[model samples]
Target: MSSNSSIKCTVKKPVEVKISDTKSSLCSGLSIVDLSFPNNSEKGIQQIESISFKNAYTAFLTIKVKSEQNSSSTGGKWKMCLHRYQLMTSPHYESGSQDYFKIPSSQMLFVPQDVVSVRLILQQPSSAWNQFGIEQVSIETPTENTNEEEAISKWLQQHLNLNSTVKKKIENVEVDEVSGGLHRMWALTETVKAQQTSASLGRYEVDDSYEINLLSYT
Candidate 1:
Protein backbone atom coordinates (compact mmCIF):
# COMPACT_ATOMS: atom_id res chain seq x y z
CA MET A 1 0.00 0.00 0.00
CA SER A 2 1.09 3.57 -0.66
CA SER A 3 2.27 5.74 2.22
CA ASN A 4 -0.64 8.13 1.70
CA SER A 5 -3.10 5.24 1.75
CA SER A 6 -1.67 3.92 5.01
CA ILE A 7 -2.26 7.15 6.91
CA LYS A 8 -5.56 7.69 8.74
CA CYS A 9 -8.03 10.10 7.16
CA THR A 10 -10.61 12.43 8.62
CA VAL A 11 -13.29 14.91 7.57
CA LYS A 12 -11.71 18.33 6.95
CA LYS A 13 -13.24 21.75 7.46
CA PRO A 14 -12.16 25.39 7.33
CA VAL A 15 -9.94 26.47 10.22
CA GLU A 16 -10.95 29.51 12.30
CA VAL A 17 -8.65 31.76 14.35
CA LYS A 18 -9.48 33.04 17.83
CA ILE A 19 -7.48 35.07 20.35
CA SER A 20 -6.85 33.27 23.61
CA ASP A 21 -8.11 35.02 26.74
CA THR A 22 -5.21 33.80 28.85
CA LYS A 23 -2.38 36.32 28.51
CA SER A 24 0.88 36.42 30.46
CA SER A 25 4.37 37.96 30.27
CA LEU A 26 7.74 36.28 30.68
CA CYS A 27 10.60 37.53 32.86
CA SER A 28 12.91 37.62 29.84
CA GLY A 29 11.05 40.72 28.53
CA LEU A 30 9.00 38.87 25.98
CA SER A 31 5.42 39.91 25.24
CA ILE A 32 3.20 36.90 24.61
CA VAL A 33 0.15 36.90 22.39
CA ASP A 34 -1.69 33.60 22.33
CA LEU A 35 -3.99 32.55 19.50
CA SER A 36 -6.11 29.41 19.23
CA PHE A 37 -8.59 27.75 16.91
CA PRO A 38 -12.04 27.72 18.52
CA ASN A 39 -14.14 26.13 15.78
CA ASN A 40 -12.04 23.00 15.13
CA SER A 41 -14.16 19.86 14.75
CA GLU A 42 -13.65 16.67 16.78
CA LYS A 43 -11.49 15.25 14.00
CA GLY A 44 -9.34 18.40 14.16
CA ILE A 45 -7.16 19.76 11.31
CA GLN A 46 -5.62 17.21 8.99
CA GLN A 47 -3.08 19.30 7.08
CA ILE A 48 -1.67 22.80 6.81
CA GLU A 49 -0.81 24.28 3.42
CA SER A 50 0.22 27.76 4.55
CA ILE A 51 -0.11 30.32 7.30
CA SER A 52 -0.55 34.07 6.66
CA PHE A 53 -0.57 36.97 9.09
CA LYS A 54 0.22 40.67 9.44
CA ASN A 55 2.97 41.55 11.85
CA ALA A 56 2.46 44.32 14.41
CA TYR A 57 5.86 45.22 15.88
CA THR A 58 6.54 41.55 16.47
CA ALA A 59 10.20 40.63 16.01
CA PHE A 60 9.93 36.89 16.42
CA LEU A 61 7.19 34.26 16.37
CA THR A 62 6.88 30.76 17.86
CA ILE A 63 4.19 28.29 16.89
CA LYS A 64 2.90 25.28 18.83
CA VAL A 65 0.18 22.77 18.09
CA LYS A 66 -2.02 20.66 20.37
CA SER A 67 -3.09 17.38 18.89
CA GLU A 68 -4.70 14.19 20.17
CA GLN A 69 -3.52 10.78 18.99
CA ASN A 70 -7.10 9.53 19.10
CA SER A 71 -10.16 11.72 18.67
CA SER A 72 -11.83 9.88 21.57
CA SER A 73 -9.04 10.96 23.92
CA THR A 74 -9.83 14.16 25.87
CA GLY A 75 -6.21 15.24 26.34
CA GLY A 76 -3.40 16.14 23.95
CA LYS A 77 0.16 17.40 24.42
CA TRP A 78 1.63 20.57 22.94
CA LYS A 79 4.21 20.21 20.18
CA MET A 80 6.41 22.99 18.86
CA CYS A 81 6.26 23.32 15.08
CA LEU A 82 8.11 26.67 14.77
CA HIS A 83 10.62 27.94 17.28
CA ARG A 84 11.76 31.58 17.54
CA TYR A 85 11.24 32.28 13.86
CA GLN A 86 12.29 35.79 12.87
CA LEU A 87 9.51 38.05 11.68
CA MET A 88 11.46 41.26 11.27
CA THR A 89 15.01 42.30 10.37
CA SER A 90 15.11 44.79 13.21
CA PRO A 91 12.91 44.81 16.29
CA HIS A 92 13.32 48.53 17.08
CA TYR A 93 12.60 49.67 13.53
CA GLU A 94 9.25 49.42 11.72
CA SER A 95 10.74 47.31 8.92
CA GLY A 96 8.16 44.54 9.14
CA SER A 97 5.51 46.41 11.11
CA GLN A 98 1.99 45.76 9.79
CA ASP A 99 3.47 43.87 6.86
CA TYR A 100 1.71 40.77 5.56
CA PHE A 101 3.61 37.47 5.59
CA LYS A 102 2.76 33.97 4.45
CA ILE A 103 4.77 30.99 5.67
CA PRO A 104 4.53 27.95 3.43
CA SER A 105 4.33 24.34 4.69
CA SER A 106 7.93 23.65 3.60
CA GLN A 107 9.30 26.01 6.29
CA MET A 108 7.50 24.22 9.11
CA LEU A 109 9.50 21.74 11.22
CA PHE A 110 6.75 19.14 10.84
CA VAL A 111 3.22 19.03 9.55
CA PRO A 112 0.95 18.12 12.46
CA GLN A 113 -2.08 15.94 11.81
CA ASP A 114 -5.25 15.84 13.92
CA VAL A 115 -4.38 19.28 15.24
CA VAL A 116 -6.88 20.26 17.93
CA SER A 117 -5.60 23.81 18.39
CA VAL A 118 -2.81 26.19 17.26
CA ARG A 119 -0.94 28.61 19.45
CA LEU A 120 1.07 31.61 18.26
CA ILE A 121 3.58 33.12 20.64
CA LEU A 122 4.65 36.59 19.50
CA GLN A 123 7.67 38.30 21.01
CA GLN A 124 9.26 41.75 20.77
CA PRO A 125 12.65 41.86 22.50
CA SER A 126 13.22 45.61 22.30
CA SER A 127 11.18 47.84 24.63
CA ALA A 128 11.24 50.59 22.00
CA TRP A 129 7.85 49.35 20.79
CA ASN A 130 5.19 49.44 23.46
CA GLN A 131 2.61 47.38 21.45
CA PHE A 132 3.17 44.06 19.69
CA GLY A 133 0.84 41.41 18.27
CA ILE A 134 -0.16 39.62 15.11
CA GLU A 135 -3.17 40.57 12.97
CA GLN A 136 -5.29 38.96 10.26
CA VAL A 137 -3.90 35.51 11.13
CA SER A 138 -5.20 32.75 8.88
CA ILE A 139 -4.43 29.05 8.34
CA GLU A 140 -4.91 27.39 4.97
CA THR A 141 -5.16 23.72 4.09
CA PRO A 142 -5.33 21.67 0.89
CA THR A 143 -8.63 22.03 -0.97
CA GLU A 144 -11.06 19.18 -1.63
CA ASN A 145 -10.29 19.23 -5.37
CA THR A 146 -6.58 18.61 -4.70
CA ASN A 147 -7.35 15.59 -2.53
CA GLU A 148 -9.88 14.29 -5.06
CA GLU A 149 -7.38 14.54 -7.93
CA GLU A 150 -4.76 12.64 -5.89
CA ALA A 151 -7.26 9.89 -5.05
CA ILE A 152 -8.29 9.59 -8.71
CA SER A 153 -4.69 9.41 -9.90
CA LYS A 154 -3.84 6.73 -7.30
CA TRP A 155 -6.90 4.66 -8.18
CA LEU A 156 -6.11 4.83 -11.89
CA GLN A 157 -2.49 3.80 -11.32
CA GLN A 158 -3.54 0.88 -9.13
CA HIS A 159 -6.29 -0.36 -11.47
CA LEU A 160 -4.30 -0.02 -14.71
CA ASN A 161 -1.40 -2.19 -13.41
CA LEU A 162 0.69 -1.98 -16.59
CA ASN A 163 3.26 -4.77 -17.17
CA SER A 164 7.01 -4.04 -17.53
CA THR A 165 6.94 -5.03 -21.23
CA VAL A 166 4.15 -2.55 -22.03
CA LYS A 167 5.80 0.19 -19.96
CA LYS A 168 9.14 -0.39 -21.76
CA LYS A 169 7.40 -0.22 -25.15
CA ILE A 170 5.71 3.07 -24.25
CA GLU A 171 8.98 4.55 -22.93
CA ASN A 172 10.95 3.45 -26.03
CA VAL A 173 8.56 5.22 -28.44
CA GLU A 174 10.50 7.62 -30.74
CA VAL A 175 9.42 10.71 -32.73
CA ASP A 176 9.88 11.14 -36.49
CA GLU A 177 13.39 12.60 -37.00
CA VAL A 178 12.34 14.55 -40.13
CA SER A 179 9.34 16.11 -38.40
CA GLY A 180 11.45 16.94 -35.32
CA GLY A 181 14.12 18.67 -37.47
CA LEU A 182 11.42 20.67 -39.31
CA HIS A 183 9.88 21.81 -35.97
CA ARG A 184 13.28 22.96 -34.67
CA MET A 185 14.02 24.85 -37.89
CA TRP A 186 10.56 26.49 -37.78
CA ALA A 187 11.11 27.52 -34.15
CA LEU A 188 14.52 29.08 -34.98
CA THR A 189 13.04 31.01 -37.95
CA GLU A 190 10.20 32.31 -35.72
CA THR A 191 12.70 33.40 -33.08
CA VAL A 192 14.82 35.27 -35.68
CA LYS A 193 11.71 36.96 -37.15
CA ALA A 194 10.54 37.99 -33.65
CA GLN A 195 13.96 39.61 -32.92
CA GLN A 196 13.62 41.93 -35.96
CA THR A 197 11.60 44.86 -34.58
CA SER A 198 9.35 46.88 -36.91
CA ALA A 199 9.78 50.63 -36.92
CA SER A 200 6.76 52.98 -36.71
CA LEU A 201 6.42 56.69 -37.63
CA GLY A 202 7.57 58.91 -34.69
CA ARG A 203 4.35 60.88 -34.81
CA TYR A 204 2.81 61.33 -31.30
CA GLU A 205 0.20 64.05 -31.86
CA VAL A 206 -2.62 63.46 -34.33
CA ASP A 207 -3.28 66.55 -36.57
CA ASP A 208 -1.38 68.79 -34.09
CA SER A 209 -3.67 67.65 -31.19
CA TYR A 210 -2.64 65.29 -28.36
CA GLU A 211 -4.35 61.87 -28.37
CA ILE A 212 -4.34 61.69 -24.56
CA ASN A 213 -5.39 64.22 -21.94
CA LEU A 214 -2.53 66.41 -20.75
CA LEU A 215 -2.05 66.74 -17.00
CA SER A 216 -2.08 70.35 -15.77
CA TYR A 217 0.45 70.88 -12.98
CA THR A 218 -1.00 73.68 -10.87
Candidate 2:
Protein backbone atom coordinates (compact mmCIF):
# COMPACT_ATOMS: atom_id res chain seq x y z
CA MET A 1 0.00 0.00 0.00
CA SER A 2 1.20 3.55 -0.85
CA SER A 3 0.77 6.59 1.38
CA ASN A 4 0.65 10.25 0.33
CA SER A 5 1.78 13.32 2.25
CA SER A 6 -0.77 15.93 3.23
CA ILE A 7 -0.57 19.74 3.37
CA LYS A 8 -0.79 21.23 6.79
CA CYS A 9 -2.90 24.31 7.52
CA THR A 10 -1.42 24.32 10.98
CA VAL A 11 1.67 26.11 9.67
CA LYS A 12 0.79 29.02 11.89
CA LYS A 13 -0.80 31.20 9.26
CA PRO A 14 -0.26 34.93 9.72
CA VAL A 15 -2.91 36.68 11.79
CA GLU A 16 -4.39 38.46 8.85
CA VAL A 17 -6.11 41.78 9.70
CA LYS A 18 -6.69 43.14 6.14
CA ILE A 19 -5.34 46.57 7.09
CA SER A 20 -6.57 49.34 4.79
CA ASP A 21 -4.06 52.13 5.34
CA THR A 22 -6.57 54.67 4.04
CA LYS A 23 -9.76 53.70 5.84
CA SER A 24 -8.30 53.88 9.30
CA SER A 25 -7.69 57.07 11.27
CA LEU A 26 -3.93 56.70 10.61
CA CYS A 27 -2.91 59.84 8.95
CA SER A 28 0.16 62.04 9.86
CA GLY A 29 -0.40 61.84 13.63
CA LEU A 30 -2.71 62.53 16.57
CA SER A 31 -5.73 64.69 15.88
CA ILE A 32 -8.90 65.56 17.79
CA VAL A 33 -10.88 64.34 14.80
CA ASP A 34 -10.68 60.51 14.70
CA LEU A 35 -9.24 57.44 16.48
CA SER A 36 -10.98 56.00 19.52
CA PHE A 37 -8.31 56.54 22.16
CA PRO A 38 -8.19 53.89 24.82
CA ASN A 39 -7.72 54.76 28.47
CA ASN A 40 -4.05 55.65 29.04
CA SER A 41 -4.22 55.69 32.81
CA GLU A 42 -2.16 52.48 32.97
CA LYS A 43 0.99 54.44 33.59
CA GLY A 44 1.38 56.01 30.11
CA ILE A 45 -0.04 53.71 27.48
CA GLN A 46 -3.00 53.95 25.11
CA GLN A 47 -4.49 51.85 22.30
CA ILE A 48 -6.77 53.22 19.63
CA GLU A 49 -8.90 51.38 17.07
CA SER A 50 -11.02 52.27 14.01
CA ILE A 51 -8.51 54.77 12.66
CA SER A 52 -9.32 55.57 9.01
CA PHE A 53 -6.77 55.99 6.25
CA LYS A 54 -7.07 57.36 2.72
CA ASN A 55 -3.63 56.12 1.82
CA ALA A 56 -4.79 52.54 1.75
CA TYR A 57 -1.58 50.92 0.49
CA THR A 58 0.55 53.61 1.99
CA ALA A 59 -1.50 53.41 5.19
CA PHE A 60 1.03 53.04 7.96
CA LEU A 61 0.46 53.36 11.72
CA THR A 62 0.94 56.23 14.19
CA ILE A 63 1.38 56.92 17.88
CA LYS A 64 -0.15 60.05 19.35
CA VAL A 65 2.43 61.55 21.73
CA LYS A 66 0.48 63.66 24.22
CA SER A 67 3.09 65.87 25.81
CA GLU A 68 1.92 67.51 29.01
CA GLN A 69 1.54 70.93 27.50
CA ASN A 70 0.05 73.50 29.87
CA SER A 71 -2.95 75.78 29.24
CA SER A 72 -5.60 75.62 26.50
CA SER A 73 -3.65 78.03 24.31
CA THR A 74 -0.65 75.72 24.55
CA GLY A 75 -2.27 72.46 25.50
CA GLY A 76 -1.01 68.95 24.76
CA LYS A 77 1.24 68.91 21.75
CA TRP A 78 0.33 65.71 19.85
CA LYS A 79 2.85 63.95 17.61
CA MET A 80 2.41 60.60 15.89
CA CYS A 81 5.20 58.04 15.27
CA LEU A 82 6.84 54.70 14.47
CA HIS A 83 9.66 53.15 16.52
CA ARG A 84 12.43 50.63 15.85
CA TYR A 85 11.34 47.62 17.87
CA GLN A 86 13.59 44.68 18.67
CA LEU A 87 12.26 41.47 20.11
CA MET A 88 14.14 40.17 23.10
CA THR A 89 14.42 36.84 21.32
CA SER A 90 14.25 37.66 17.61
CA PRO A 91 16.87 39.69 15.79
CA HIS A 92 14.53 41.17 13.17
CA TYR A 93 13.17 44.69 13.71
CA GLU A 94 9.83 46.39 13.20
CA SER A 95 9.85 49.85 11.66
CA GLY A 96 8.27 52.29 9.19
CA SER A 97 7.21 51.04 5.77
CA GLN A 98 8.95 53.84 3.91
CA ASP A 99 12.54 54.33 2.71
CA TYR A 100 14.71 55.52 5.60
CA PHE A 101 13.78 57.39 8.78
CA LYS A 102 16.23 59.99 10.05
CA ILE A 103 15.67 58.61 13.52
CA PRO A 104 18.01 60.02 16.11
CA SER A 105 19.84 57.50 18.23
CA SER A 106 18.51 57.32 21.77
CA GLN A 107 21.59 59.26 22.93
CA MET A 108 20.27 62.77 22.34
CA LEU A 109 19.82 64.74 25.59
CA PHE A 110 17.52 67.33 24.07
CA VAL A 111 15.03 64.71 22.88
CA PRO A 112 12.67 63.73 25.62
CA GLN A 113 12.52 60.22 26.99
CA ASP A 114 9.17 59.95 25.23
CA VAL A 115 9.78 61.35 21.72
CA VAL A 116 9.42 57.89 20.14
CA SER A 117 5.83 58.76 19.38
CA VAL A 118 5.62 59.92 15.74
CA ARG A 119 2.88 60.50 13.15
CA LEU A 120 2.73 57.85 10.35
CA ILE A 121 1.88 59.49 7.04
CA LEU A 122 2.32 57.59 3.76
CA GLN A 123 3.80 58.96 0.59
CA GLN A 124 1.11 57.26 -1.44
CA PRO A 125 -2.67 57.45 -0.92
CA SER A 126 -5.35 55.04 0.26
CA SER A 127 -3.57 51.69 0.05
CA ALA A 128 -3.69 48.37 1.86
CA TRP A 129 -0.94 46.29 3.46
CA ASN A 130 -0.65 42.86 5.01
CA GLN A 131 0.01 43.66 8.64
CA PHE A 132 0.83 40.30 10.18
CA GLY A 133 0.06 41.29 13.74
CA ILE A 134 1.29 43.40 16.60
CA GLU A 135 1.64 41.57 19.90
CA GLN A 136 2.43 44.09 22.60
CA VAL A 137 3.66 47.63 23.13
CA SER A 138 4.43 49.34 26.42
CA ILE A 139 6.04 52.47 27.76
CA GLU A 140 9.84 52.47 27.87
CA THR A 141 11.27 53.06 31.29
CA PRO A 142 14.43 55.06 31.86
CA THR A 143 17.21 52.89 33.13
CA GLU A 144 20.37 53.89 34.98
CA ASN A 145 24.15 53.45 34.58
CA THR A 146 25.00 52.42 31.03
CA ASN A 147 28.51 52.49 29.57
CA GLU A 148 29.51 54.61 26.57
CA GLU A 149 31.41 53.68 23.36
CA GLU A 150 32.02 56.30 20.66
CA ALA A 151 33.36 59.85 21.12
CA ILE A 152 29.80 61.16 20.98
CA SER A 153 29.04 58.87 23.86
CA LYS A 154 31.78 60.61 25.84
CA TRP A 155 30.36 63.98 24.82
CA LEU A 156 26.96 62.96 26.14
CA GLN A 157 28.62 61.68 29.29
CA GLN A 158 30.34 65.02 29.85
CA HIS A 159 27.07 66.85 29.21
CA LEU A 160 24.57 64.51 30.90
CA ASN A 161 26.46 61.36 31.94
CA LEU A 162 26.48 57.64 31.09
CA ASN A 163 22.70 57.29 31.07
CA SER A 164 22.42 59.95 28.39
CA THR A 165 24.51 58.05 25.87
CA VAL A 166 22.92 54.73 26.75
CA LYS A 167 19.47 56.11 26.09
CA LYS A 168 20.49 57.27 22.61
CA LYS A 169 21.95 54.20 20.94
CA ILE A 170 19.47 51.40 21.55
CA GLU A 171 21.34 48.79 19.47
CA ASN A 172 23.28 49.37 16.25
CA VAL A 173 22.90 45.99 14.59
CA GLU A 174 21.36 46.89 11.23
CA VAL A 175 18.18 44.87 11.21
CA ASP A 176 16.09 44.10 8.16
CA GLU A 177 14.68 47.37 6.86
CA VAL A 178 11.01 47.40 5.85
CA SER A 179 11.35 49.66 2.79
CA GLY A 180 12.68 47.32 0.14
CA GLY A 181 10.64 44.45 -1.21
CA LEU A 182 8.02 44.04 1.50
CA HIS A 183 8.62 47.32 3.33
CA ARG A 184 9.00 51.10 3.04
CA MET A 185 9.76 54.17 5.14
CA TRP A 186 8.66 57.78 5.52
CA ALA A 187 10.38 61.13 5.71
CA LEU A 188 11.56 62.26 9.14
CA THR A 189 10.29 65.66 10.26
CA GLU A 190 9.92 67.78 13.38
CA THR A 191 6.99 69.89 12.32
CA VAL A 192 5.69 69.96 15.92
CA LYS A 193 2.34 70.75 14.30
CA ALA A 194 1.22 70.16 10.75
CA GLN A 195 -1.93 69.74 8.69
CA GLN A 196 -1.03 66.45 6.94
CA THR A 197 1.58 63.72 7.56
CA SER A 198 1.75 60.24 9.16
CA ALA A 199 3.94 58.15 11.49
CA SER A 200 3.93 55.12 13.88
CA LEU A 201 5.12 53.72 17.22
CA GLY A 202 4.84 50.60 19.39
CA ARG A 203 2.19 49.72 22.01
CA TYR A 204 3.15 47.66 25.03
CA GLU A 205 1.31 44.44 25.54
CA VAL A 206 -0.53 43.63 28.72
CA ASP A 207 1.18 40.26 28.88
CA ASP A 208 3.41 38.40 26.42
CA SER A 209 4.62 39.26 22.92
CA TYR A 210 5.89 37.11 20.06
CA GLU A 211 7.37 37.58 16.59
CA ILE A 212 6.54 35.44 13.58
CA ASN A 213 7.66 35.20 9.98
CA LEU A 214 5.03 35.95 7.36
CA LEU A 215 4.46 35.62 3.65
CA SER A 216 1.74 37.19 1.49
CA TYR A 217 0.14 35.60 -1.54
CA THR A 218 -1.39 38.94 -2.48
Query: Backbone clashes per model, in order?
Result: 0, 53
By TM-score, who's the top model here? Answer: 1
Shift of residue 149 alpha carbon in model 2, Å = 15
The lDDT of each candidate is: 0.68, 0.31
Worst 10 residues of 2 by lDDT: 2-11
Tens-place lDDT per residue, model 1, 1-218, is 21221122222232323334558533343544444445555667777666788888889988877776633464465778899989889888888878999887689898877777677777777878766777777777765455667889987676556566666665676768667998999999999999987965434555666555442331
What TM-score goes with each of the models?
A: 0.53, 0.24
Tens digit of lDDT per residue, candidate 2, span 1-218?
A: 22222111111222222335755734321112122113322223222211222221222333344433311244646544333222112212223332222223242222332221323322222224333222112223323344445566768657665565565564543456434523432333323345454843324322344223212221
Q: Please, what's the RMSD in Å of model 2?
A: 34.0
List all candidate RMSDs to the true structure.
Answer: 17.8, 34.0
Model 2 earns a TM-score of 0.24
How many angstroms is residue 200 displaced in model 1 relative to the true structure, after the best TM-score fit? 42
Candidate 2 Cα outliers beyond 4 Å, as residue runs: 1-64, 70-73, 79-110, 113-135, 146-218
